[model samples]
Target: MKKKFILLSGLATSLLLSGCWDINEAQRMYYVDGLGIDYKDGQYEIYLQLINFTNVAKSEYPNPQTVPAEVGQAKGKTLEEALFKLFRSIDQKVFWGHMTFIIFSEEALKDKNALSIIDTVLRYRETRYQIWTYCTQDSIKDILLLTPILNKSLISSKLSTPLDTDDQETFVEPVNFRNLVIGLNEPNHEIGIPYVTINKNWETAEQQGQDTTFIGVGVLSKSGFKGLIKNDAARGMQWMHNRTHRGEITFKLDGDETDFLTVTLEKIKVDIEPLVKNNQVTFEVVVKLNATLNGLKTNVSEDEIRKKIIKEVKKEIRTTYKEALAKDIDIYRLSEHLYRKNVKVWKRLEKDGKIPLTPSSISKLEIDVNQVNSGRKTFTGTFND
Candidate 1:
């Protein structure tokens, strides 16, 4: 009787343990790794990036083979309708649990459509909040079709993992779905998202290769896509953000003939102070950077070097601020600073955003750069003869 009761208990436990009875087979599931969305003619265009798992996971296979990624497209009046249209064409069960990144074209991100897409994605039970977010002005089809060089999987490419390159030298910090959602809710603010382009600066053994690169930042508000901040203005905008990371800088000394210094920035911080008086607001910008001297074309003291860095950094900040104001973009987030520090003043000044920010709005711009000790180390030793 005891043995029979024990056997019965074991059977009950086994029945409870059948948790995966409803699990779908991997072979029957189509894993979506990347998503690209574009808008045209009052319709939503959806593009899906699906890579062969065999090529994506090399170590698991004894002799891994390269497989070109497959991209599919569908259009509809609504995002769901378009998605379902694409679903009707595919034979396998599509899965969103493995989505790595999402790309929004400049057109699709307009008029708060980016927020709409995020809302839809979040509603799906299998969707991820950590998926990297980006916007591009390039061709989505061309980008999805370009495979990684040397048989490498898209898993390792900048398209899927951008911070891999940003860590080396950050231009614009990468944004994720969760980050975008939170940023969109900020009052009177637009977020800086990485702006990408297709670059053909690489070559393979047989032919030139193409890859995706973020040249500047794409600013998006609840109002939707503002515009692209390209070139130095984009880079300088980063230097003013709290997310500023390590990067290289080259600046020439003022009033000098080709006397320049190159340094790699380390721990960087940006601070903004809003001074309001008589219902008038002005922002004071201060930037601090710990940097390592990389190259020097002229001889200068450490103090002079620090001063030169400060001058260059301040100039860059002012330049970016000027450009941002022209486009009605608050790259420095000065509006938020005022809203938090002096709400009443912000209200008065915010009445007419037509000219909320002007060149004179920045009463002060300062920079503090500290140098890290580097170069060949000298060791003293004693030798006996």
Candidate 2:
């Protein structure tokens, strides 16, 4: 009887020990890494950047060989139709959950087309809100096909992780999809997303390569896509943007011809006050930043460096406003500033469709540079000399 009970228990354990019979191999699935959307002539085009799961994970592959990403394109009368048409051509099971980036073409922003595309993306159950969004005037296929340098995983590209680059370079701030939606919803507010382009400056012994970089930002208004502002003109954006972490500036002080100073700045602080007087509204902005001398070509005091940096900062902010004013763009969202601080004035000007700020609208500007330090090494001259 004891032997019979032992046999029955062994048989029951075998039933519960069955291995995973329903799991599918990752090698059999096509994982989309990035998406591209474009619209022109009343038609929609979709591009997909597909990655091999083996390349993305270390243990997934036995040999560990890597290949460049694959880009596929399809077109239809609508965004969904284009996506489905692309699906029809794919051979394996498609996975969308790992997608990290989406790019839109300039033509796609016309006639409220951006709205429908954004809505469709959010409606997809597998997609996430953290996806980075960008606009490109370059070829969608080219941007999607650009691979990581040194043959690294495709996930290493700035398209998938922008803040990685910003931590060191800190140009136009990279923003994700959720922040984008909030910018559009807020009344009279303008938001910016990175403008991606293919840079061909890198090459290896056997082959040349392309890298995606931001030359500026694509500004968006509530109505639709506003326009793009170049980086040099938007220099002040690094500070007024409220998201700047660290950046560098190089300049020559007054009365110093042969000497120039390169400073690395961090800990940016900005304050904007909406000043209302006699039914007219203007904004006063004050900015504070800490500096470290990276390169020095001539002798100068810490006090002089601080004052020169302040002057440069003030000039950059005014120049940004001046340039955007030429394009009829309130790049700094001064309209929204007024709306939040002085709603009565904003409503009055908005009712007349006159809230688009002027150059004089930035009534006062102040910049304070502080906490100077000698960087890794000094160049050409000594700070004491």
Best by TM-score: 2
Clashes of each: 0, 0
lDDT of 1: 0.78
Leading candidate by lDDT: 2
Off by over 4 Å in 1: 1-19, 59-64, 253-259, 351-355, 372-374, 377-385
TM-score of model 2 vs. true structure: 0.87
Error of 2 at 266 (Å): 0.8
> Each model's C-alpha lDDT?
0.78, 0.80
Q: Candidate 2 on 1-385: residue-level lDDT in tens?
A: 9999999999999999868997767888898889999887788988999976767774223233556578889898988888888888899888888899999888786548687788889889988889899998999988887766766677777898888877786777877879888877776556787888899999999888778888888777667777777768878788786578898887887675856777888988888898888877888898888898876666667888888888888888888878877866777877777888778888877732338577788888888776888766543365564
